[model samples]
Structures are given as structure tokens and as C-alpha cells.
Target: MRMAAGTEDRERGADLAEAAPIIRANGLSVYYGTKQVLSDVTLDFPSNKVTAIIGPSGCGKSTLLRCFNRMNDLIPNFNMTGQILFDGVDLYGPGVDSTEIRYQVGMVFQRPNPFPKSIFDNVAFGPKINGYEGKLDELVEQSLRRAALWEEVKDRLKSSALALSGGQQQRLCIARALAVHPRVILMDEPCSALDPFATLAIEELMRELSEDYSIIIVTHNMQQAARASDYTAFLMGNEERIGELIEFGETRQITTNPEDERTEAYITGRFG
Candidate 1:
């Protein structure tokens, strides 16, 4: 028998509350020059779970994701207020190394961006630069297996990564991220460039990966967010509020019975 929606939501909330969040954002506001992109956003990301950020175009979902690993620092005139905590440490605090932070938090972009080098080289690049002392080949194989690409590309490891299909290249990118042993993986519209079949494959891989790594994805597809994530955050912004988190909760709760009317409207096709 199924529980009532309220009861289910309460139980899930309690369970999540008990787990220490792997990442936390408090009063996180970002800006590029004088334009504010995000404002006073505070949220907790549960450990070892998939969290999806859904919003309309130009809502700063990608910007928020980039902040977690300090990717926004590369952009000129990028400035942010407030704190993002990883494992209880402030990411923007003084004396922190952004390069080390990036290694611990990997990212995969929207397009399947594979290197011009061979598949083996692509996976080994991160570890090689970081001065890995262990067996390089084993690490490459393990990362590929974790990303569910080893079986398909095992026989052709020497082939150029550009030679793989779109889906395979994305998986290769995922493998490259995993090669560095990141605790969290950030995906920015990972399936927007793929066909339905390839999209499904990526979703399946996400589910499996969530058992070992915290996965945060930004997707425009509502169905993909509902199907692939354990928790969902709905963001909306206007001329006044650039990117504010409207509602955040379990996937079922947020998708089925959102407490905010704005969330209901966006999810039900009433308005963006």
C-alpha cells in the first residue's frame, strides 16, 4: 500500500535531514560585473544522491553549478557573496586552492567534449598531471567501468576519443572526471546534445553513479529531472530576482505536489 503524499513527504524530509549534507550553500549571491545572476540562495545537497536543478532559460543554473567548484573564478569580473561549504569547509575562504577543489569536484559539460587524443590518453590526463603514483592503466579501466563505457570501448582504447559516437564521448568525459577520484560530479545539460536512446543511457549511468558519487545536474527537460534525480530544486527569476531557488524537496514531492503555486504553474505548463 502507498502512503499519503503528506506523510511520504514528511518522512523523506526527516530522513534527508538526518544525513549530513555533503555540500551547503548559504546566502550565495553571484554577479558578473554589476549584474546579479543569483541572489541569496541557500540549499543543502544530500550526500551520495542525485540533485537536479530545473529552471527556464537564463536562470543561472549553470552559474550556480560552477560556483561549487570555483569555475566562475576563471571568468573576469566574476564576484560572489556568501559561502559555499564543501565537507564543512568554506570553498571561497582564504588560502584555499581552486585547482585542488576542482580535482575533488569534477564537471561534465553539455556537449560531448572529448580530447583529440586516444581514449586511453583522455582518461589518464588528469591523473598524470596530478602526479598519480598508482597504476595508471588500472585507474583508467576502473573509471571507464564506473561510467559504463569500458565494455563498449575496451577493444578500441587506442582509438581517438573523437571517433566515438556522441553518447560514448560523453561517457568518456564522465570517465575522465572520475579518473581523478572526485567526490562530486556536476553536469550541465549533459543530455541536451543526444538522441532519446543516448539520453536514456546517460540517465541510467547517473543512477548507478549516485551510489558512489554525489551527482548534481542542470537540465531544461522536466521529464529528465523527474526521472533521474532523487531531489529537485525549482529555480525562477525575473527582472528583480535573477536566480532564486523557489522550492526544493524530494523529486516526488516537488514534481507531484509542490507547495509553491509558482512551482505548480511551471511544472504544469501554465507558464514558464
Candidate 2:
């Protein structure tokens, strides 16, 4: 039976409120040199769930996602203020190793970006770099299975990743991220580059993965956010081009009964 939207929202809210957050942001802000992109954004990403960040273009959705693993550090002159805590540790604290943080919080790009190596090699790369002492072949198979791509590519593990279809390659990328056993996975519009069937495949994979890994995705697709995520954060930019979190809550409420009128307007196609 289909539940009423309010009933679903209330149930989900109660459940999520009790779950411990795997990552918490406090007064988070991002800047590229002199330009501020994200301003005073704060939110909690609960463990073993999918949190989707949705906003119009230039709203810094991707910027906030990169802050999780400190990917923004790679960009020159990029800086931030405030705390991004992972498992109670400040990500930007002194002596923190960005490399280790990245291993714990892996990222999947918008496009499928598998290396020019074979399918087996693509999945094995991370485990190899992180110095996995166990059997390499087993880890590769396990990662592929977790990404829901093992059956299709088991026979062609040696084939070049480029030889696979677009969806297969994206799954291969996901399998690569899983090989490292990351606690949290951040995806930036993971389905934006795929066909409808491929997009659905990724969404299904996300649902299954949430059982073991906390997933955070930045997406512009409203319907996708409504369908795939457990929680939704709506962000909007001000006149000065600084993005801020306007509303955040269970996906059902955020989509059906957003507390902020701006969020409702954007979701209803009135404006972005």
C-alpha cells in the first residue's frame, strides 16, 4: 500500500533523527581565491544512507561534496572556513593527511572516468595503491560484485575499460571506489552523463550500496533526488553568488512540502 506523504515524512524523520551522523559540517564556507562560493552551509549526513544535494547551476553543490574528502585542496588558492567533521575528527585540522581522508571518503565523478587499464586493473588500482595484503583477485571480484557489474564483466576482466558501454564503465568506476573500502562515497551527478537505462542502473546500485556505505550525491535532477535519496538539501545562491542551504529534511517532505518557499518554487519549475 502506498503511504501518505505526511505519514512517510514523519516516519522517515523520526528514523533519521536517531541515526548518528557519519559526517557533520558546522558553519562551512568555501572560497576560490577571493570569490566565495558556499556560505555558512551546515548539515549532517547520516550513516548508511543516501543524502542528495540539489540546487540550480552555480549553487556550489559540487563544491560542498568536494569538501567531504578535501578534494578542493587540489585547486590552487582554494580555502574554507569552519569544521567538516568525519567520525568526530576535523577534516581540516592540523597534521591531517588528505590522502588518508580520501581513502576513507571516496568520490565518483559526473562522467565515467575509468583509467585506460583493463577492467580488472581499474578495480585493483586503489587496493594496490593502499597496499592491500590480501588476495588481489578476490578484492577485485568483490568490488565488482558490490557495484552490480560482476556478472556482465566477469568473463572480460582483462578487456580494456574503454571497450565497455558507458554504463558499464561508470559501474566500473564505482567498483574502483569500492575496492578501497571507503566509509562514505560522494557522487557528483553520477547519472547525468548516462542514458535513461544507465541512470536507473546507477540509482539501483546506490540503493543497494546504502546498506554498507554512506552515500552523498550532488544532483540537479529534481526527480532523481526525489526518487533516490533518503534526505534532500536544497541550496540556492544569493545576489552575490554565494550558495547557502535553504532547506533540508527527509526527501518526502523536501519534495512534497518544502518548508522554504524558494525550495518549493524551484522544485515546482517556477524558478531556479
Candidate 3:
């Protein structure tokens, strides 16, 4: 039998509190050039769970997700203050390697961006570049299988990844990320460009993936967040008009009984 939602949330919270957070943001503020994009946001992401970051457009949801892997460092004028910790290690600390961090924390973009290479090659690329000494074929097959794309593409492993349908290409990209054995997967509007059927497929895949990897997704779709995530974080512009986290809690709570008026407003369609 299923437990009541409140009981489930409390039990889940108790269990999570006993474990260390897989990722944490402490007073994180981000800026480009002179304009601050995010302001003093702090939160923790539990391991092996799906956490959705939701907000209206231009609210720094993507910026916060990118910070986990130091992706913002690539921008010319990007700067941030405060700490992002992964497995308790400061991601931006001295002696930490951003390249290795990215390997552990993979990203899937808004649209399918499969390489021009064949499907087999795309899945094997990361492992090969990392000097994987295991059976390459088995590794590729395992990754594809985990992504739920192996059976569909198994017969045509040598076919060009670009030739696959849009949904298949996105799954192939997921397979590529899994090949690296990443601990966390960050998806930035991963379903924005897909059809309804394809979107459903991805949502299902995410639930399955959370059993093994931490999944943090930035989405503008409230329905998607309510349906797919275990936890939700609502971010919006503060009085200063820079993105700041308004409320965060179990998905049920955030969607149904948000603590902040702003969060309620955004979720209830009163205003973005």
C-alpha cells in the first residue's frame, strides 16, 4: 500500500538527513561582467534522487546547474562568489581540476546534439578518450542498455548518430554521458525541443536513471517538475531583481503548498 504524501515526505527527509549531500551550494552568487545573475542561493541535492530547478525565464536556473561542474568558468566575464561542493569537496577550490569534475558531472543540453559520428563511436568516445582498458564493445553496449536505447539501436550500431530520430539522438547523447560513469547528470531543459511522445520517454528514463545517479534538471515546465522530480527548488528575482531561491522542499509540498508567496504565485499561474 502507498503511504500518505506527508508521511512519505517526512520519511524521505529523515533518511536524507542521515546521509551526506551529494552536492551543496552555499551562498552562491553568480555574475557576468557587472550584472549579478544569482544572489546568495544555498541548497543541497541528495544523492540518487531527481531534483528539479524551476523558474520563469531569465531566473538563473541554468546558471546554478552549470556551477556544479564549473561550466560557467568558460565564459569570458563570468564570476561567482560562494561555494559549490560535490561529495564535500569545493568544486572551485585550488588544486581541483575542472576537467575531472566535468567527467564526474555530465551535462545534456536543451536540444539533441549528437556528434556526426556513428552511434557506436559516440557511445565509446568518452571511455576511449579516458583510456578505458576494458572491453570497449561491452562498455558501449552496457551504456546503451542503461540509456534504454540498446535494443532499438543495437542492430545498427554502426549507423550515423545524426540519422536517428530526434528522441533517439537525445537518448544516444544520454548513453554517451553514461559511458563516462558520471555520478551526477545535469539536464538543462532536456525536453524543450522534443515532441510529447519523446518527452514522456525522457521523463521515464530519468526516473530509472535516478536509481544510480544524481539527476538535477533545470526546467521551466511546472508540470514536468511536479511529475518527474522528488524535490523542487523555486527560484525567482528578489527585490533587487536578481535570481534568488524562493522556496525548496519535497515536490508535493513545493507544488501544492509553497511557503513563499512568490513561489505560490509562480506555480499558480498568477504571474511568472
Q: Per-residue alpha-carbon lDDT of model 2 for 132-249, expressed as tens digits?
A: 9999999999999999999999999999999999999999999999999999999999998999999999999999999999999999899999989999988899989899888778
lDDT of each: 0.91, 0.91, 0.89
Model 3 / residue 57 / CA error / Å: 0.6
Lowest summed-lDDT stretch of 10 residues in model 2? 1-10
lDDT per residue for candidate 1 within 1-48, as digits (tens), equals 111222335556676777688888888899999999998888888889
Cα-lDDT of candidate 3: 0.89
Candidate 3 lDDT trough over 10 residues, lowest sum: 1-10
Better of 1 and 3 by lDDT: 1
By summed lDDT, the worst window of 10 consecutive residues in model 1 runs over 1-10
**RMSD value for candidate 3:** 4.2
The predictions' CA RMSDs to the true structure, in order, are 3.8, 4.3, 4.2
Runs in model 2 lying further than 4 Å from the true structure: 1-14
- Of 2 and 3, the candidate ahead on lDDT is 2
Residue pairs with backbone atoms closer than 3 Å in model 3 (clashes): none
